[model samples]
Target: MIGFYGDIVFETSNSRILTFSELQRSTASRWAKHEVIGKKPTSEFIGPDLDTVSFTVNLNGQYGVHPRDEMNRWLIKARSGTAETFVIGNKRIGVDKWVVKSVSQMWGVILNKGEVVTGKVDIELEEYVERL
Candidate 1:
């Protein structure tokens, strides 16, 4: 069944709530793979490598929230070394731990009388683990 979903919010350990205005994409890669031996295929060889999770999140079209400068500050603050989690459908699903890889600003600046009206952010995160 096709299920309609809402905006996914990712919460950092420092408690920054990022509400996406337009989420471009998100990806998760599995770890294990099957290998072929000399004659036959071998079983799946899994390592301690954590799954990678990456996505671009937008912060435009939001009202009554923090201003553009404040949003920018939060983006910078997210880079601190801490574990983050995901919030899908407003439910606290904190199973996956993430760390911010990068945060670049997506250019869609609406202007009102030569002043910035709204802004957006494009961020990338990677699933985190302490050791391999």
Candidate 2:
């Protein structure tokens, strides 16, 4: 198993061909600039911004994965604003749960029956923190 986003598992098996690539993570700090009369503006640290993660997943029916079905799962979660735990190699991704920020799909191979045989999905996730 490579990693998992909520209930969607990324793995390779005789009957399932789901895996990820081009995984990228980003972190940022919130800073504010204070204007100065004569000198350079001073900066004030506000806090830490939410971390973001982006990756691409390839789906192929020949490897045992249904592209449309898997893509629907991601769309459903993103539409509902669901926060789910993300794990990769037995390690959690962020400080708290992560929400699906976006899901972009590209259909590569399709048959005459309009069945998608191969496709790729790019997913973006942001850290989810509960309000006190």
The candidate scoring highest on TM-score is: 2
Clashing pairs in 1: none
Q: Write the per-residue lDDT of candidate 1 for residues 1-132, one digit (tens) a residue.
A: 111111233433333444544433354444555666676655554454445443454443344334466456546546565656655554533346666666676446657654444566665555666554
Q: Pairs clashing in candidate 2?
A: none
Per-residue lDDT of 1-132 in model 2, one digit per residue for the tens? 988888998887777768999999999999999999999999999999999999998888899888888888889998999899999989998779999999999998988888998898899999999875
Candidate 2 — what's its lDDT? 0.90
At residue 110, what lDDT does model 1 achieve?
57
